[model samples]
Target: MQALLNVILPVFIVLGFGYLAVWRNWFSQAGVDGVMVFTQKFAIPCLLFNAMANLDLGQSFEWRLLSSFYIGALSGFALGVWGARYLFSRDWQDAIAIGFCCLFSNSLLLGLPITERAYGSGALTANFAIIALHSPFCYGVGITAMEIAKARESGGRASFFKVLKAMFSNAMIVGITLGLIVNLLNVELPEPLGEAIALIARAALPAALFGLGGILVQYRPQGDLRVALYVCVISLTIHPMITFALSFATGISVEATRSAVITAAMAPGVNAYIFANMYGRGQRVAASAVLIATGISIVTAWIWLTVLP
Candidate 1:
């Protein structure tokens, strides 16, 4: 219990501090945005690159983990779509929005930090292995599906190739690609260069949590309460359950199975909101789902950590 609290308390404290900062107007929105940009473009990329560059990919990579995690993720996504379409009487765009809310875990900001602390940095190799697959599956499929739906609605055209191209151009994807190449070639980063990367990478932790807090302060749950609650049920609860069951059924490595399940337990990714806002479909509902899921996830994550082997 003490060990678990040690892992969990600091995360909430940092997140709480960020919320207090923004709530009290100590950090303006612009200031928070700047910090977020740094975290997204520099700190996170550096962190991922450093982790991947130095690791033994041969031993670290787990196909079972990816398979099991995605199985759960896609399952949750399909459920969200069906629920929104039939249960909530939503159109396809709204269903896709809800589906994304269910599937996309907040892997970078919340999952990475919590997993690093809760399971230790040793577990990070497994978590990053999941992170490597996150954007590809979540954004690649989610964005393409949403775009296709929008185009169909508007009598326009949409292409999966465009979505793939945009997704590959993402900074995190670029970092992951470079890191994989380096790891595959067994390239040793020089001491100075490695230290430089490490210094920048270290900033991701606090920056991400703080950014999350600030963004939460801005999000108002002004949407369909029923739909938001339904999304939360899928995202915060069902997704993790599916992940655990699938991971166990697959009999993956202990570390990979644990990491995959825990990552699946994370709250809805903020990118869900970004996509909703961009498409202007079910924006408020997406925000509401994120808010509710994030608030509820603290308890759910602790429960998962307590119960998981």
Candidate 2:
């Protein structure tokens, strides 16, 4: 109860404040969008780069932990895709979008703040690893799948190089790459540069949370009730179960295992909606999935936090 009140509640409070700000017209829709863009393109990358640059890479990464977490994510992705295609009779693009909602999590906006509150700052490296890979793996596969489906629609081949180029051009990927290079080579950043990065990174979480809350205020779940319900179940329940089981079976350190499981349990990310909108496929369902999953995750996150040590 203390943890919930002190840690979790504050997050939602800030989120709620954002909702209030928007509703009260303190911040216009354009203003909120601008904030989100700044957070994603600048603030988040700085935060990720700082985290990756500072962590002891050799000691931080455990192959078993990485494998277990990804296996769970991939499994959920596959299940979501298959269910959308066969059970829902969705096309490949829409199915892949749904799968993305299942696999991609709100790692930046929600994961960092909640985990930092629950497990302290030391737990961030694992979360960083997950975030760094989130865009590349989730978006990469999603774009590729969608492109292939589009090609099939027109009787042509999708370009693998195009996918690679898109992935490489991602802001998060650039941040991750630079961070990894600095870490691997033991390159020390200049004091001013480091401070500037840290300063920008500091605002990422709160701003992101605010933007998310504002988005929630706008994106109501009015699509197919059944599709929304399916997304909610897959994101909130199945993802966590697979992550927990795989982490336990792999026998990573208790801390790492716990971090992986909890992070995996977060709601479907807004990125899923962004991707869906980009492709002009299943945007309504994707929006509903993210909103519904976020609403439900409050309870599910509390449950997991209580059950986990």
Candidate 3:
């Protein structure tokens, strides 16, 4: 059906194109870097702003649903960290890497677009609520996890508040904030500026996805199949499954709740991996985890969509 294709087809196409581009050596890191720069500097801001511009901001947000999702992701992340510590007996860095991977989902690059395609405008708004929570939680919990993990490895401490502030200032967050301001003011971007933002903002997803593909090339796994497998089971399989079970309990609108539930399950959540690697906490492990987790998302997405209410 058109619905499934709209959601499913483009996801693979992007992946496939990324793979081909890499396979053909079409772009260097510099090229990918250029794309990222453009998106982050311009496109992403536009996309975030434009996305908010259309939302009906007055509708009461479902605090319960968002809270449950956030709490569940945090708990799931903590559970993974605890288990990884016991099983791996690894330093905090690796444990935090695993924890962040388990907690974060690919809501922006993959989840939101698909939700928009499948459900419509309101679903996009619902996804926005979930995404708004994602960066703050990931940055906050992730920094704590990283510092805990890193102290053992590097004898250094990470300032959790500093990390939180940095995430709050990230371009995406600024875009969201500014977009909300514009929406609240009942103002639209003027024609010239709006056109530029639209053009640049359109590139954010592709740039991110392509950057993800290129980043995948560096994954060597460090001979830890178990690490990759464990993270996958938690991130790809368990997280969404848990969301669905909770969804069944909530008796919310099936379509909206289902979008959140299944997306939570299928999202690969590359940011966690990025942060983990950046902080010297199992970079290779996080890289491998991200690559494998994202690869699995396509099949898992089909499965989750088919079975979820």
Best by TM-score: 2
Of models 2 and 3, which has the larger lDDT? Answer: 2
Better of 1 and 2 by lDDT: 1
The best-first sequence of candidates by TM-score reads 2, 1, 3
Which lDDT values do the candidates have, in the order given? 0.85, 0.84, 0.71
Q: Write the per-residue lDDT of candidate 3 for residues 1-309, one digit (tens) a residue.
A: 544576767866776676667667887756766766776667766788787666676552476566556666876687778877888787666787778878888878778666766666466666776766577667778776666555666777767677767678777887878877887888966799878878877777777766666656666467667877788888777777667666667765676576677668755566766677677676666777777877777777767776764
The digit string of per-residue lDDT tens for model 1 on 1-309 reads 764578777887898888899999999988889888888888888888887777777776667778888888998899999999999999999899888888898888888878888778888888888887788779887888888988998999998788988788778887888888898888888899989989998988898899888888988899699999998888778888888888888888778877888889888988889878867888888899888888888888888888888
The reply for model 3, stretches above 4 Å from the true place, is: 1-6, 120-122, 148-161, 185-188
Superposed model 1: Cα runs more than 4 Å off: 1-4, 155-157
Error of 1 at 177 (Å): 1.2
Best by lDDT: 1
In Å, residue 29's CA in model 3 sits off its true spot by: 2.8
- Model 1 residue 59 CA deviation (Å) reads 2.7
Query: How many Å off is the CA of 114 in candidate 3?
Result: 2.5
Model 3 weakest 10-residue run by lDDT:
59-68
Backbone clash count, each prediction separately:
0, 0, 6
Estimate the lDDT of model 2.
0.84
